[model samples]
Target: MGGNGKFSRWKISFHRAPSAAKKEPPQEFLCPISNSLMFDPAIVSSGQTFERACVDICRDLKFAPTLSDGSKPDFSTVIPNLALKKAILGWCSKTGSGHPSPPDNSEIESTIRSLSGSGGTLESPKIRVSEKELLKGVTETPPILLSHAATELNSRDLNLSSSSEESVIANSTPLLPFATRPSCFSYSSSPSTSSEFVAEEGSRNTASINSSSEDENFITKMRSLDVYEQEQAVIQLRKKTRTSEEARAALCSERLLLALKQLLNSRYTALQTNAAAAMVNLSLEKGNKVKIVRAGMVPPLIDILKSGYEESREHAAGAIFSLALEDDNKTAIGVLGALPPLLHELRSGTRRSRHDSALALYHLTLVQSNRAKVIRLGAAAALLGLLKDRDLAARVVLTVCNLAACDEGRAALLDVNAVDCLVGLLRNRAEFSSESTRENCVAALHSLSDRSLRFKGLARDTGAAEVLMDVVKADSERAREKARRILEGLRGPETAEDGEVDWEAVMKGGVTQARHRVGKSSNRNSTEF
Candidate 1:
């Protein structure tokens, strides 16, 4: 019996009817340009087979061979076969036809059933299933034997039954219930032998079971005990901050100051400018005026004022202006000697920075200890130079006039012939079109008149007297009042009766007293030129 069993197994394995061999391995083909496999096959006008089709067949066969030798099979044998030729011709004809007909509803349903499954569970809901009715007519019979009986019954009854009765019989008959029906039986319309149905059902069930088992195995492998815990640990780690205090300490440390100094010395203009401004803001907030003054920032600020970058120079001048306000910082600012540079900035810097520097100088000059130092540093000459700047010219004139109103500042300013510069600016104001310039010029002359009658004589000598007379007659009341005062100073009793201006007597009586008297009716009426 063992020998017989082995013989049977051997016969089944080796002597079984031979299946047809797969077609020959595809040919090797190359592209002319790249000398590599042709990527996509195409037919051209040439009669001979080109590289493309052969290359594609070879590429597919390289990974998966239709034959077992691991070599590309000869394509010519397959290409000439009648069945393959017919299939190829049919595909080409369908593709080349102008418009292919769409599949009928039955064909579409068959294709969907083949792909999804013959089970009613897999079938779409649009195709109705009468499960209870089908089972009721089954009569407790086996499906294969019952289907044959049903076929025989259907044929035999055709002769006796009327068409309506046949329809009723067809409706009442149940060939198979959905769950018990073999997949192949559900697809086959002809109720014949059940062997083919069993074979197809076995194949489909085998594939579905194998695929489900693989999916379950893969899902089981992917699940891990520590995954959630590890993810939570990562999130917790990200939330922790160990170096926040260290980072803040580094920013405010002396290293930051050194970095700032290096940045100020950087070759890049933008870096230098930005670092300088940042340092200025930080120092101003911290009141570290001494650090700024000692770091030689003043000279660089003056240099920046001379440069073309207006914004940098403006901020630099502003920083210096703040420093100049502090009495303790005055000596340091004076040591770096900002007055000369500030004066230069006032003369040559952008209009905004020039005005700022002028205001700073004005404040600096107010410090009695620095007043002599400013004059000695040629600040007077620098302010006189700014009289030519269109924006700052009027401002410079005004500042000088205010300084001249001070006895000591006025004395120092006069020593530099600052009066001559003022008179020159007044003479230049006549040609300007801006009313502000004209008004400022008049006001400066008025301030000068409030200083000394000699300034009044100087105003008259420079034709400022005529300019004031014009302003007095103008419609603006402020201009009129300003002009009226200057006129009285020039023609008032402060002048000698002999028509000579007594600057010495006016200086002795004080300019404020003379200004008060000039507004009086007695001084205006009784006094003569």
Candidate 2:
């Protein structure tokens, strides 16, 4: 009995012990379905046996086995779980030595029956073992079972004769029970107790799967909704207008003019034009004069007047006209360097552009500096050219009248022959039939005549006195009033009282007549040699 015990131990050691020639650890099996270390392996009635489905699953998932080659198998092209099938088939062919051929569909059942007992009774029939029990008897149970499972599945489709099956079964040996626990294999045999655990696990998986998809759908819906809302908002804003209070507020804002200047560079032409137009309209408002000058927008506007598109030039001209009505902006007009381009526009631009240019120039000349620049830029000739245009002539005449009201501007005007131009425009009544044109011309001449006694003689020599007389004969009250004032100023001292010129009589009798009478009286008082 002692020798038998020693022999049995030796046989177990020979079958179970690792070979010294094996440099790498043995391969393990993984379950194809669960993708985990195979456990609770069992032989089913369908002629198939899985020793470690869990280990086979792990191998299929590319996990390391308890005793596997250090180098990983190339799995780039391997389908998921294919490693399990390959492991199972290879294991079966090597393990089953030479047992007689089992029935094709009953190999697992027959093997189980042989291992437990051959009796046809419930107690004799083989009992299925859990993965924990199978691991207890094998040193490398995880890898061995995994390899066996992979080998079986992979070889199932291959031709295998009964003799080969017998050979494999006869050579097969049961693995001895291991002394230590298998490191890479484990199993839970506890029966499930509650439905909530299953439901919770399933819900977690479903939530994870749908999270990205749900977020994408939400973002798509929000973007579509935002696009519609933004378009509607733009349309509604366009339809709204500034209230009276808002207009007042804009007039008060120092940034209003600056903001309009910046809009001149807008990519949208319509927006640029609209902003410029709004600025022009704003400048025309009562009490908004200070805002226009203090905004430091005058220079850019003048630049626009000189070089911007047609619409911008018109708007800039209008703004200048509004600012010119104020004494402050009038002085700054020359600093604007706007006279040259303004005169050019007045002479050659479209009717609206020309008109605005003339108006702006008219306002600018009301200031001394502006009058100087006008003379420097040859505006005298430009103004003279407009004498042929009755409408332009009237505007020019009114602006000249205002300029001649100041001493410095009057001198500058006379220096540029502006008085002579006015005289010529007045005498050319054939070209100016409009009552307003003739009236403005007469008023301008009268203002010139009132500047000095010498201007009275000059006016008469230029035939301005006759033009005033013709205007006085006209039926229009304004024409007669302007013509009468011009004639009175031309009459000179006869229209003076208490060292103050009789402004009422001069306005009524015309400065031309007043200056003419003064010139005759002065000649008489001088007495010839």
RMSD per model, one decimal: 46.4, 49.1
Residue 212 lDDT (model 2)? 41
**Which ranges of candidate 2 are over 4 A from the true structure?**
1-260, 266-268, 326-328, 415-420, 451-457, 475-529
* TM-score for candidate 1, residues paired by index: 0.39
lDDT of 2 by residue, 383-490 (tens): 766767744554566566666676755666666666667666656655655444555666666566564766765665566655556666653566677666655555
Name the candidate that leads on TM-score: 2
Q: Write the per-residue lDDT of candidate 1 for residues 1-529, one digit (tens) a residue.
A: 9999999999887844433342222232322212332222222111112233232222222211232333332221110112222344354454442222211223333433443344324412233224454333233323332111011111122211112111111211123212211111122223333323322222221111233443233233223244333222211111110011111122332434443454445444444444444444433322455555665566766666556255556556666765565667776676666777677777666544565576567557656556667656656666666666654553465456555555665556655555566546545544443444455556655665674856654554455554454565542455567766665566555433434333333344433344444445335433322
Model 2 — which ten-residue stretch has the worst lDDT? 145-154
How accurate locally is residue 42 in candidate 2, as Cα lDDT from 0 to 100? 27
